[model samples]
Target: MGTWEAVRRGRLLIALLVAAAAIPPASSAAATTLPKKAKASSPPELLSELPVHAGRLVPSSVVFPIYGDVYPHGLYYVVMNIGDPSKPYFLDVDTGSDLTWLQCDAPCVSCSKGPHPWYRPKKSKLVPSGDPLCAALHSGIAQGENSGQCDYEIQYEDRGSSLGVLLYDAFSLRLTNSTRASPILAVGCGYDQQSAVQDASAPTDGVLGLGTGKVSVLSQLSNQGVTKNVVGHCLSGKGGGYLFFGDDLVPSSRMTWAPMSRIGFRNYYSPGPAKLYWGTQSLGAKQIEVVLDTGSTFTYFESHPYQAFLSAVKSDLSKTPLIEEFDDSALPVCWKGQKPFKSVSDVKKYFKTLALDFVKGKRALLELSPENYLIITKHGNACLGILNGSEAGLRNLNVIGDISLQDHMVVYDNEKQHIGWVRAACNRLPNADDHGLEDGDLSQYASMGVLK
Candidate 1:
C-alpha cells in the first residue's frame, strides 16, 4: 500500500510482540493479549547500576521510519538518545508499535524477506552480539548465549517481522527539555525480511514500543529502581518532547486522571504518533483506558459509531469508474474517458478525505484537488469496502490506531492515569524523509510535523 494510503487505510497495519513463547490463555481475545503484572513498585535498588545513565545526559537523535517512501526525505529525527549514555539505539518509543528491535549484522538471506525496509548492520557502529563489547547486552534484553548474535521475530497486531541479531548500539531519547541523551542499554538490529508491498526499510535500527507490558523497554528499565515507576509523556508536536524512563522524569503538578485497566499485553495496545480527542462527544460512550500504538497504521474500534460516522459523510462522494476491492488490481478499463478512474491510489485518497471530519477541526485534506481524489469500485459495488479493519474482524475492541491519532500530540502516562491529547498543527514538509524505505517506492511519504 502507498504511504498515505497505509496511513488512511489504517495507521495500525503493522505490529508485533514476543510473547512468553507460549499460547495465551483461551480467555484472551483472539486479537488482544493482556500483559502479565510484574512488581507493581519499582525495584528496591538498581541491579547492577550503570553510572552512564546518570550524570549529565547528552543530546541524542533517533530516526523514525517513514513508511512507503524510498529516500532520506521521508525520515525525521526524534531526540531519543539522551547524551552519551552507555547504551544507545534509535527507537520510536511508541505504544502504537510493539516489537523492540534494532539494526544488526547483514549478509543473511533471512533479513531480506519483507517488502518494507530493514535495518543494515553495516552502517551502525554497534557491533553484533558476536562482538566482545556486547556481552552484557546479551545478558539483559538480548538474553541468550547459545548464539552471541541478536535475532528476534515479532508479530504485531497487523504485521509480522523478522529482526536480525541484536547489537549493542547507541540511541537518542529526547526530553522535552531540548536536551538529548543516549540510553545506556540501547541495542541495534533490523528486520531481516519484509513483505514487498509493506514499504519496510532500514531507517535507524528499530522501534521501541513502550506499551503496558513486560516486553516493553520501560518495563525492562524497571529492573533498575524501586518505589519509582517508569513514566513517559510523549508530546504530540514539534516543540519536541521527552520520554522519562524512571519516576525522576515526571513533572510536579496535578495530573489528569484515568483508572488504568490492566488487560492482556497485546490485546489492548493502541496505535500512535498520538491523536487527541477533545470534548465529551469525542470520548464516546466507552471509558476505556487505552494505549497509543505507532506500529499500526489504521484505527480499530468495536462497531462503536462507525455506522454513524459513515452515515454523516457518505453523501459527500461523487460517482466514479473506480472499483474498490478486486482480487486483482489489473482491471479492464472499459470507460476510456471517465473523469473519475478507479484505482488503489484513488481509494486511498478517498479515505484520507473522509478521515478529516473525525478529528476536531483537524483537516489533513492537503492539495487534494477534485482531480486528485479519484474513485475506486463503482458507486454501489459492495466489493470495495471503505473500512479494512471490519473485514479483518478487529472491531470487537476500542482502539485509536494511527489514522485516528494523526496531527495531535498524545501524552501516554502509564505512571499517571489516562491518555491525554492536545491539538497540534504541523507543517508537512515536502521533503518527506525516507531514510528507512525500500528502493523505487514513491508510495511512502513521511511527514515530521514541524509543530507550528
Candidate 2:
C-alpha cells in the first residue's frame, strides 16, 4: 500500500496493520460462512441464500457515499456501520490496503482522538488464535505466543503503528437494490495507535481496506456470496463522490481497461509500464511501472521522471505571464498569475495536459489534464500535484493518487484481474435501474431462509 501524504506539508504516513482473522452467522439471512477445509468436499460454494425484504429480491451490490477532498482533508472517507447494534465509524477509503480496522476501547494504551468514540467489543466477538484467518495475519512469523486471542500490529512507513486484536463483527450494509444486509467480517480492534502527525484529532476513525487480498473486506463479502469480488469509486473534484462493490454497478461498455500487472507487489493495482508524455512530445523518461493508489494524496514519479517533468513545466511557463511563486510552501512547485487563482479552472488554460501511455493494453493512455495535476492553494496560487517518489522513500515506484483520479470512475475488477476507468460526473450515484440482473444471474444467490 502507498503511504498517506499530507497535502499541506507533504509528510507521508504509510500503513501496515497486522492481526487476523470470518464466517457468516446462520441467524441472519445476509450471513453465510465459507466451509472449513476439513468439512468441505470440494471448493467452498457460493452462499446458498440471500436476504430478501418482504417478498422483493435485492441486488448484491453495496454502495457508500464518499466524503472529503484532496486539499485540506488530503483524503476521502466513508461512514460505516458495524457490530450487532450497529454504530457508525468514519473510515478513510483506501484501495491500497487490505486489512480493515477500527480504534478499540480495549483499555487503549496509545490512541488518537478520532471522530467517534472507540469501539467497544464483546468477548464473543474476539477471533480465536487458532482460526485460519488469524494464521493468515501472522503469516511469515511465529504465532503460538498469542494462544488465546489473535494479536496484530501494523506499522507504517512513517514510523506510525497500530496494535490490536482480531474480531468478527457484523458490517451493516444497504445494497443498491434498496435492502439492508449485515455480513460478518474480520476487523482489527486496534487498542494502540502511534502516529507521526502530532494533531490530536484524527482525520478518520480507521481505514476501509479495499485491496485485492484474501483478508480484504471485498474477499470476505465474496466468500459469503454477498457480492462479487469487485469494487469501484468515483472521487469528484468538487468534494463528495460514491463507492460501490460488485459487478452490477459496472458499465456494460465504453470504459477502457488495462491488464493488471503482477510485476511488483501483488497487493496493488499496477497497469504495467507506461511512457510519460507532455502533450504529444515524449519527456525522454524511461517506461515506468505505475500503481493506482487512493491512499496517496498526490501523484508521484521516480526522481528522473520527476526532474524531467519539473524542468519541462518550468520551461513552458517561462514563455507565459505566470511566474514561479517561490514563497508559497503549499507544494514543492507553485505558479502565480497576474491575479490570484481561485481554482484549477482559473489557471488550467495556461498549462498543458500530461499523458501516460501503457505498454500492455490496446492504446491504453491515461490523460491528465491541467485540472488533474494542479491544485489551487489557500493563498490562491496554482501548485503542482505531482511529487518526487524517490525523496519519499518510494525509490523507483510511481503512484497515481487522488489528484490524478478526480472525476473519473476507476474500477478494480479483482475477479477478472483488470482495472478500468472512464471519465464521469462523480458528484452523484449511478441510477440503480440501469443495472438489472441478467439471465441465470439470480440463481447465483440462494433462496431466502436456505443455508449451506
Candidate 3:
C-alpha cells in the first residue's frame, strides 16, 4: 500500500498556499542555515530476540500531546522520544499507512529539511534481513535466505520516495496511569528521501504510521503488551489535540460505531458503504466506501459523489449573493461574498449541512457542516475542502480527511474490528473521571481481559 498519498496531497496544499501568497517569505538567516548532518554508522549484527516486553503492572493506555494544525501546516504531528538517549523527533501522524519511519543521518543521499537533526542509529540496532518484519516490507517481492541488513524502499503515488534500512529502537512513553515504559520497536531509518514538491518549510521529521498492518507501531505495541491494539485521536479545528493508544479515553456510551470494511486493502480504516445526503435530501449518488485518513488535508469523494455534491452546493447558492471565485487558486471550488468571508461562519448561511448515512451498523450518520468542508483561505474567501478523488488518482476510493474530522473524537478499535466517533470539544484532554476510570485502576481493564 502507498504510505504517502496523504502526504503528497499535503504537499499539493503547500504548493497551492505558495501560489496564493499565503506563506510569508523566510528571512535570509532562516533560509541560509541548513540542517546539520550526522556521521554514518556501520550496520549491526542480527538481533537474537525481541527485547521489549510489558509486565502485568504496565499501564493499559498512553496519551501523547499533538502539536501543529491543518491550516498552515496541512498536518498534525506528535513529538516522540526515541533511541537510548531518547531524542525527540516530530512525526506527521498518519493513520492510512503502516510502517513508521524517520529520516536518518546515515549520510543521506537526499533529505528534506526538518525541525530536528537527523536520527542516527546505533551499530547494535539494525534489524536482520531474515526477520519476518523485513519480509513484510518486501511483500510481493521474492526474498533470498541471506542474512544482512533489512533494506527497504518506499515510493509514493506523488513520486515521493524513501530508501532505508530497518532497525529497532527504544520508544520512551508515559502512560495515562502515571507509569513510564520504554518499548523497543521496529522503525525505518531512511537514509535517502525525495519529494515531488520540495517545501523547505514543512516541519515533519518523518511519518508516524498508525495503520492496522502488523508493521504498524500500534500493532507492535499491542504485540509487546504495552497497550491494547486500539488508537484514537481528536483534532481540534482551532489547533492542538490529543492522541491516545488503547481504550481508556473511549466513552462507555453515546458514541456511534460502524463495522470496519473487510472488502478492501487491510491498511486503511474503511467504514463500509454510505449514501450521500444534502441535509435530509439524498444526493442520488451510489453508496460510497469511506476511509478515514489523518494524513490527508482535505476530504475526497468519488467522481459521481463529488460532482453531485458540487451541483447541490451550487444550486443552493443561486439565490444568494455569493459568486464563484475562479481567481482563488487555493482550492478547486471557492465562493466570494459581497465582502470577503472572515471565517466559515460568515458564509455558512448559504450552504446546507451534508451527511453520510452508512448502510451498516445502525445506519450511523456522519454530518458535515459548512465549517467541516469549507476552509477560509488567506484571501478571506471560503473554499470547498472536498475534492474529486478520481482526479487525484484515487479512482473509486473516497477519503475523509482532516478538514472533515475537526473537533471530533475518532476511534479506530482494531481489537473490535470497528470504528467509532462522537462530537467532541477537542480543545482539552478528557479527564480520567470523565471516562469513568479512576486513576491507577487497571482492575476494570483486567476484568475485560485486555490487561495482562
Candidate 4:
C-alpha cells in the first residue's frame, strides 16, 4: 500500500501561506516531542503464567470507540476522514507503534520525499490541534505540531519504512450491527516502504491501533457510554474483517472465552493478551506467554522449546526434502511426489523445475521476485519448511502467528474471554503430513473459545 502526494499542490500552498504571512515562525517555535522510554531488546523469555480462561458475552449491547481503517500490507492503509466522513485515505498503519501519527510538514530534518497532498485548514473545518474535538479524539501520539506541510515519518524494528506528511480529515465507521461513529482521521501525506513480494495488492496508509485503554479508540467508545467491546473478526476471504466498535455481536454463551492480560501500553509490539499452551494443556504450569503478531509472517520459537519441537517432529519433517535453502529472491523451491527429497543443484534452476506445497493439497510453482531465504538455524542450511514443531508443542511457547495459523479465521472476541478460529483455506490431498484443515490435529483449538 502506498500514500501519494501532489508536489505542485504543496508548492502552491507554500507560496500562498508565505504571501499571507500565515506560516508559523520557522525557528523559535518549539517542536512537539513525545515521551521516550527504552525497553530491553533481549529476546523475550518465559514470564510468570496466568490461568487460561475464556470470556463470556454478557447480555445487552456494549459500544466501543473505533477508528475505521484497513492494512493491505505492512504498507498502505485507509482511515475514515472526519471532514468528509464519506471518504477514507490510504495511509500507513503500524501496530508495533503507539504514537498514532500521520505525515505533517514541519521543516524537520526527517521528512518524507516525493509529492503528495498536504492538509490545509483554509479548505477544511476538521479540528486543529488543541481544539476540544482534536484533543478528545483519542490520539496517543506525543503532542506534536501538525505543521501544514503535510509531511510525516514513523519507523519499525525491522527498519520497515513509513515516512509521510499529515493530512487532517474526517473518518466514518460502523459497527457490525451498523452503529455509526466517526472521528477525525489523520491521513499520511506520503509513504516510503518496500512493496510485499507475495501479495502485491496491499495498500499502505494510516494505522488502525489495537491498543488497550479507555483512551484508545475501542476504549474511548466503551467509555463514551456505549454497550459493546470492540468485536474484531478478520475475514480472510474478503481480505478484511468486520470491526464492531460499540456492539456485542459475538455469541458469548456459545463461544469460548479467555482471560485478559495487562500489557505495557508503550510496548505496542507485544501480542498483549494471548497465551501459549503446550499442545492443549493447562496454562502457566505447562504453558508460555506469547504475542500473536500478524506483521511477522514467520514463526520464531525460543531456542529451548524450538529444539524440543524439532526433536519431536524431526521424524515427520525428515521425510520431506532436506533442502539447504529457499531463496525467494532467486528461484523458490518446489518439491514433488509423496515424499519430497533434498536437491543439490543451482537453487534458481531447481526451483523453476519444482513446486512447493504451501499447504497440504495446494501447490504453486515458485517464482523469483521479492527475496526471502528460508535457512536452518544450526548448520545454516537453507531449509524448505519452517514448521518448528518444538517439544513444548503448543503449551510451552509464547505465540502462534500467521505461519502457524494459516488457513484459519482468527476471531478476536474480547467479549467472550478467548479467541476463535474457523478453518477457511484447507490444503488437502496426499502429503507426508496432513497439514489440511479437516486433516491434521484439531487439538490446538479444542481448548480455546473455538466454535463449530
Error of 3 at 412 (Å): 0.3
lDDT of each: 0.35, 0.73, 0.71, 0.30
Residues 54-160, candidate 3: write the lDDT tens digits: 63434377777677666756778887888877788888788877778898876565677778898886546666655676666565342443434566666544455
Candidate 1's error at 76, in angstroms? 7.6
TM-score of 4: 0.48
| Cα shift from native, residue 353, model 1 (Å) | 14
Tens-place lDDT digits, model 1, residues 1-452: 22332222323424444422222222332112111211111112222222234652222222222222111111222323321332333444456543456433344444422223334442233333333223332223443333323344555444445444334333333322223333334343543445323554433335666665444555444432221234443332222233334433233433332334444544243322212222112324443333445444334434444444343334323354333333423121112223444443433433333221222213411121221112233432222222334544554444544334444434445555444444333222111233222321222212111111
> What is the TM-score (0 to 1) of candidate 3?
0.84
TM-score of 2: 0.85
- All candidates in order of TM-score, best leading: 2, 3, 1, 4
Which runs of model 3 end up more than 4 angstroms from their true locations?
1-59, 140-142, 199-201, 434-452
Please write out the lDDT profile of model 4 over residues 1-452, one tens digit for every residue: 22211110000000000011112332331122111111102111211111223642222232221222111121212343433424333333222232343333332223333233322221132223333322323233322334323222334333334443333443444322323444333343322333222223333233444344222344433433333444343322213222233323333333322334434323322323332222332123223344444433334455454554444333434555543244322112222333332322322232211111111111211111111213222222334322332321323334333333333334444454334443442221112132222322222222112111
TM-score of each: 0.50, 0.85, 0.84, 0.48
Measured by TM-score, the strongest candidate is: 2
